[model samples]
Target: MEVKVTSSTILPSPTSHHSDIPLTIFDRFAANIHIYVIYAFTPPTPSNADLISALSKTLVYFPTLTANLSTDCHGRPCVSVGGPHEDRGALVVEATVLSKLEDHLPLTPSPDLRLLHPDAENPKHLLQVQLNRFQCGGLVIGLTSHHRVADGRSMCAFTIAWGKILRGVPIDPLPFYDQPWLKPRNPPLVQFDHWGSEFIHLSPQSNEFIITRTDVDPSEITNLLLHFSPDFITKLKAQTNKLSTDKHTTFETLLGYLWRKMTIARQLDDEECTTLSVSVNGRRRLQPTVPPEFFGNLVLNAYPKAKAKALIEGGAATAAGIVREGLRFIGEDYFQSFIDFGEVYGDRDLVPCFEKDGNVLSPKIEVDGWLGLGFDEVNFGGGGKLCAFLPTWVPFEGLLIFSPSLSQSGGVDVFVSLLEKHAVTMREISHSLD
Candidate 1:
C-alpha cells in the first residue's frame, strides 16, 4: 500500500510501567543501551479520539517495555532484567515522538549522522517522524532505531506487534524473543586462533588515533548490499567448500570484492593493510548450542584479510577468490576456536587487525523474512502504512547491507555508507557489477 508522506501529531510521554524491579528480556536488553527510535503513521480516515486512546493502551500492556536499571553479578554496571511476567528490569526510553510525515532523507551516507553521548545532560538520542496528511487524512510512517538494544530484524518484529495491538487484532506470531544463543559456554570452550585479537581499546601510548567522523551529503554514502541470484548462490555453495577450497559463498565472495573496492575508494597506498570483517552469531555454534530463540549479544567478529596492493592488482574475480579462501578457513572448528577466545577473554579488550590508519569494509547478506516478517502489520492508533528498518550507526568505517528489495522486482535493497574520500572510488566499483 502506498503511504502518503506528510502529516503531524503530538505524542506525550508514556505513563511509566508499574514496576520496581527488573522483569523480562526486553527490560534487560533496553537497559544496557540508552537509545531507540519510533516511526508511526495514522489511518487515512483518521480514527476517532477514543480509538487513538485504545490503540495507545498497548504500550502499558507489556510491562517489560518500561524497566529500571540495577547492577549485575559483578560490581560492574549492568541491567537488572524483569521476568517475562512483568516488573523486574531496567527501562530507559531515551527519545519518543509523534509527528506528521514529510520528505524522506535519502538512504545514502551523511556526515551529520546522529551521535550518542553518555555525558549529555539530557537524552542524546533523537526521535523524528515526518507525517503525510492525506486528503482522506490517513498516514504513513518511517522510523530509525539505535543499534544498542536490537538490530533491524528484531525492531521490525516489535513494530508489527505494536500494530496488531493498535488495530485490536490478535497478536499473530506473538513476539518471539528467544535469545539463548549468546550465553557463556557450558564447559567454557577456550582458545586463541584467528580471533586471538579483535576490537581493542586504544591505549594512551598507541600512535594510532580512534575517531568516528561523518562526511558531507548524507545521501551520498549509500549503503548497498549486492545479492547473487538463488541459482548463483546454489552454484557458489557447490563450488566453494569451507573446509578445503579457498572459496566461500555470497558473504565471502562479496566481501572479497568489496575489500578491493573499498581500498580503491579510500585511495590507500599499496603498502597499507586492508581488512574485511563480518559478525557471526555465536548461538547455535556455541558449545552445547543455546536455544535458537535465546537472544542477547550472541555475536562474534570475523575478519578475512588481503593487502591493498595484492587486491588492486588482482582483478575482481581473483580478489573475490582470495576472500573465499579466507572465509573457508572459518568453518565450525574456527567458530569453536573463537568461542574459546571469548571464554578466555570474556569481555576484555582484544586488539583488532584493522589498525587506526587501516581501510576496512564490512558487507552483510540479509537472511530471509528478516525485517519484513511483520513490517506492514504494525499499527498504533491510526495504524501504519509504510515503515522502514533504520540503523543509526555504521560502527565501522564503511558498512554495506543487502536487504530484500521492497519493490516487486525481488532484487535485494543495497545500503552503502562510507567516508567521503572513499565514496568516489566505491561508486566506480559499484558500477562494475558482475
Candidate 2:
C-alpha cells in the first residue's frame, strides 16, 4: 500500500524546562538507534489533530524528547535542551495509506516501514511520530524515539503521560530526571568482571573485531511473530519445574525454553557454545533504587552461555538456572562497578559487542522482555486502547522481543528475526510446543 506524507510540523518542549543536559554513562553507551513502535486502532479512532495537540503539551513536561543530541568537550553524547531561538521539538508527520490497516498487521522492515519512523541514521529530531490513516477509517500511530534519550520503560512513561493529557487527566507525580543517582563511585572501582564472557573488547587483529554492516539478501531472512498461549506457557512451566527443585519465574522459564528451541532450530554444532543475552533493567536493581520514572537508558545485558548440545539436550530447568545465575550479577555492587567502568572508559570508545553489525561473537540470541511495561493501558482519548504493539523491524539476526499479547490472554507475542531456513524450523518448534 502507498503511504504519503501530507504535512510535517515541530512540537517543542515547554519553555520552563529549557536547559542543556548531560547524558549519563549508561546513556552514552546506548545503541544510538531509533526504536519504532506501532499502535493500531479500529474505526472511531482518535483524531490526528487532537493527538498532535496533546503531544505538543506533553512535550512540555518531557523536554528532553524535544532536545537535540550533541557531543561535549570530551566527545561524549549530551543533549542541548531548549536552546535560544531554537526549535527543540519533535517532528510530527501526517500521512495517509491507500490500503486497509490489516494489510500490515505485523509490521516489518521495508521502504514502506521506513516511512513509519523518523530517519534511522542521523535522526534530526530526538523523537518523531507518524499518524497514518487507512482508507477504512482505521489509524496507526507510529513512534520513533532515539535510544540514547530513553529506554523502553521511559518511552512507555511518556506515552502514559500523553494519554492522560489527551483524556484531560492530571499527570500526577512528574518524572524524575536526576542523573547523579547513577554517578560513578568516588574512587572508581572495577569490582566484578562485567565484560567477561558476554562482551568482547574489539581490537584490530582480534578474532572478535567489529563490523559496522554486512550485506544479506532480504529473501534469505525471515521475521515472524510467534504466539504462546497462557495455557501453553503454564504447561511448559510445569514440565520445566518437574526437572528442577527450585521454582522459575515466567520470564526465566520462557526465555530458557525459547533459547533452547532456537538453538535446536539453528542446528548448530554440538560443541559450540551458544549465548543468550538478556537486557536487565537496572532501575530497581541498583542500591537506593532509582525512581521508576527516571528517564534515559538504565539497562545492562546479562549473558548466559551454554554448550549447544547441553542447551538442546538439557531440560528447561537447566537453561533456567543459567539465566537465573546470569541475573545474579546485576545487584547493587555490580551496577556500581559497571558505572565506574563506564566513567573510566567512557571516552575510550568502548563499544559493546552486540552494538556492532555483522555476525555476533558466535551463535547467540538476545531477548528483550516487555511483558509488563503497561503499554496496552495507554489510551489516547475516547475508549480506544492500543490494539497491537510491535517494533517496525528487527535490526539483526537472532534478536527476539517478547511482548504481552494485545488480546490480554496472559500470553506472549514473540517477534523473532533469523535466517529463512532457521525461521522455518522455529515455526515448526513453536507449533510442536502447542
Candidate 3:
C-alpha cells in the first residue's frame, strides 16, 4: 500500500465555551469519520493531484467533514458558530500509489486502526484513507470514525457523499443534521445517582478480548431480518403486557432466551453467572415524547441477571418472558428519572471505560429507529445507494443487534457476534427456536 499524507488540516479553536466546562452535544459529538477505499484501477491510473482536487471540492459544501483541534484551544475541533476560525475543519486528503496491493499488503478484512494511542484519545476525530494501488491493481479504502459524534449510519452517509464527489456530481439536498429534538431537560430531569453502583464504564478495566485461534472464516455479516408475522409479534406484545401487568417483565424474557442460547453455545460451567444488557433511550421517557429527529446518544444499558445453568436449561418461552419483564422497567418514569444519572454517579470518580469482570457473559441489545427515516435514501450524485455497518463492538463478548434491514420488510434484522467456538452451541440454540 502506497500511503502519504498530503494535507493535514486542523480546525481553529472555538470562542463558544470555556475549556473547563463539559462540551455540549455538538461540541463533544461533532467530528468527522475517516473512510479509506481500496479502488482497483485499470491501466489508466488516475492522477493523484486531480483525484485529491476533485475530492476537495466535495468538502466545499461540507466544510465540517475534515478537521482537528487548533493550537488556540486544547486540540478540540472547531465549531461552526463564529469568527474566521469557525468552520476551519478541513479533510486531510492523501493519495498513496501502490505498485501491487496483494503482494505488499495484509489481506485481513479489518484495517489496522490504533484504538488507545495517546495522540488519538479524543472521541470525535478519526484517521483514515484509500490506497489507489495494490499488487493486483486493487484499491483498499479504510474508514475510521469517532464514535462520539456520529453513529455508523451517519458515517456511511459521508462516505456516499465522497463517492459522488469523486464521480463529479452534485449531492442532492445536502444531508440534514438538525438535532433540536434531543434537548437536555431544562432543569435536567433525571439524576445520575445510581450509575456508579449499577454501571461500569471502560476505564481501568481490562475489557480485552482473548482471541482464540479458530478455523472459521470471517464473512460479511449481513442482517437477517426475522419475519415474525404481525400475528407473532402481536402475540409477543400481548405476552409482554400480561407480564408487565403482573410486574414480571417482557424485556427480561427476551434476554433470558438470548442469554440462555449464548451461554449454551459457550457451554459455560453451571455455576457461572450470565449477564445480558440492553439500551434504553431516555428521550420520550421524559414528560414529552422526544422529537423523532433527535440525534445525539441518549442511551442507558439494562443488565438482567441469570445463572448460566438456569438459562441453558430454561424453555424458550420462559426465557423470553424473563427478558420481557426486564424491559418493563424501562417505562416512561424510569427514563425520565434516569436523566439525573450524571449527577447521581458523577462523584464516584468513574472515568469512562470498558467493564471486564470476565466472570459473566453480558450481551447488549439496541434497537434504534433510524430505519424509519429511510437512511437508504441518503445519496450523493447517484454513485449508488449507501450501505452501512457498525464497526465497534460493545464490551460484552456476545453482542446481539436489532436493526432495520434493506429488504423493506418493516421487520427487524438481527445479528449476533460471539466467539467462534460457540458456533455449534449457537446453532443448537437457534435450532430450538426454529
Candidate 4:
C-alpha cells in the first residue's frame, strides 16, 4: 500500500475577485475544519494535465475556491481574494500507486485511507486536492475544503462544475454569490435563545464534530462503511412508518433506525438520554429562501433526544417521530433568529455551546444526509464517471454520514465513527432488523 508522491503544486485561479469576501454569519456558524471528498473513477479517466487545466478554468467561476482565508483588522474571518497577500491557491498533490484498482473496489473508511487525501493539519490553502493514480489507470480524486468557505452542497457544485468543464459542457446553474441578502436587518430583531442553543460561555475545545469538540484521540476511533441495499431501505422505511402515518422521509427513517442501533450497541442505561444532532440546511427554510445553488454554509443542527430506554424499547416508529419533530423545530423563524443573533454579537468572538446538561462524556451523535445532491452528474468523460464517492476518513467518535451510494443498485451508504468496542458490536448487528 505504497503511494509515491510525484509532484506537489499550488494552482491559482486564472481570474480573481480582487476583494476580501467577508464570511456571512451562516459561514461563521459552521465548523472551521477541513472535510474531504473522495471520488474513485474506473480506468479510462481523463489525464491529469487535462483535468488540472479544466480545474483552473473552473476556478475562474469560483474565485472563493482560489482565495485564502484570513481575518479583517477587526479580527473577523474573511476570504482574501487576489489581495496584496494573494499568492494563495488550491494545493494539488499527485501520487502513484503500484497496485491495480481492482484490489480496492468498494472503498471504506479506515485510518490508512487518510493517505489517499492531502494532509489537513494546519492547512495553508482553504481547498486542497490529491490525484492518486493506479497502475490499472483508475483514478481517485480526493478533495478537501475548509468548512467555513463552503458546505457539502457547495463542494458538490464545484466538483460537478469541474467535471462539466473537463467535458466542455456548460454549467447549468452558474455559481451565485449575492451575500448582502443574508445581512441582518437594520435594528436587528433578535428573537431566539441563540446564546443558549448556538453560543457558549467557554472557548471551543477542538474542531467541531456535529456539535461536540472533544479531547478524544484519533487512534481510539473506529471508522466503518455500511451499505444499505434498496430492498433493505424499503424494509426500514416500512418499519419506520408502521406505527404512525407521519410519512417520514428516507433521511429521517434511516437516521432514526441508525440512532436506535447505535444506542443499543452502546448499552447505555435506561434513564440516560441520548441526543442526536441532525444537520439542517437553512436554504429553503429562510424567509425568502436562499437558492439551493448559493455557494456557502447554511447548515445548523437539530437536537433530537430521547431516553435510551425509549429509543430502544419504543421501536423504529417512535424514533422516527422524534427525528421528524426535532427537524420541524428549526423552521424559518429559527433561521431568522440565528441571523439576528449574528448581527448583534458576531463581531465579538462566540463559541458554540457543546453540551446542554454539563455531561462531560456527552451522549450525543451527529449526522449529515448527502442524498440527491447531484453527485451522479459529475462525469469527467473518457468512458469514466463516478464509480464511488465517500469520505477519506472519519476521525471523531459518534459522528455519522448518510450518503447516496454510487453503486449500480442505488442504495444508501452509511459512514460512521464510534468507539472501537461499540463499532464492533454495531457491525455485528447493523443489518439485523430486530
Error of model 2, residue 15, in angstroms: 3.6
Q: After superposition, how far is residue 317 of candidate 2 from its true place, in Å?
A: 1.6
Better of 1 and 2 by TM-score: 2
lDDT of each: 0.43, 0.78, 0.43, 0.81
lDDT, candidate 2, 7-76, per-residue tens: 9888756664445677777786567677878877777777888999999888877888988887666676
User: Alpha carbon lDDT of residue 6, candidate 4?
Assistant: 94
Ten residues in sequence with the least summed lDDT for candidate 4: 353-362
Tens digits of per-residue lDDT for model 3, 340-373: 4543434343333123233123333233333333
**Candidate 1 residue lDDT tens string, 198-278:** 434445654443534333454434443444455544454444343334445455555555566677777777777665555
Cα-based lDDT at residue 209, candidate 1 = 39
Prediction 4 global C-alpha lDDT: 0.81
Candidate 2: regions farther than 4 A off: 16-19, 84-88, 102-112, 118-122, 195-215, 359-362
Output the better candidate (3/4) by TM-score.
4
Stretch of 10 with least lDDT, candidate 2:
353-362
Candidate 4 per-residue lDDT, tens place, 97-186, comes to 888877888788766666777775557788888999989799988888888889988888999999989999998789898865567777
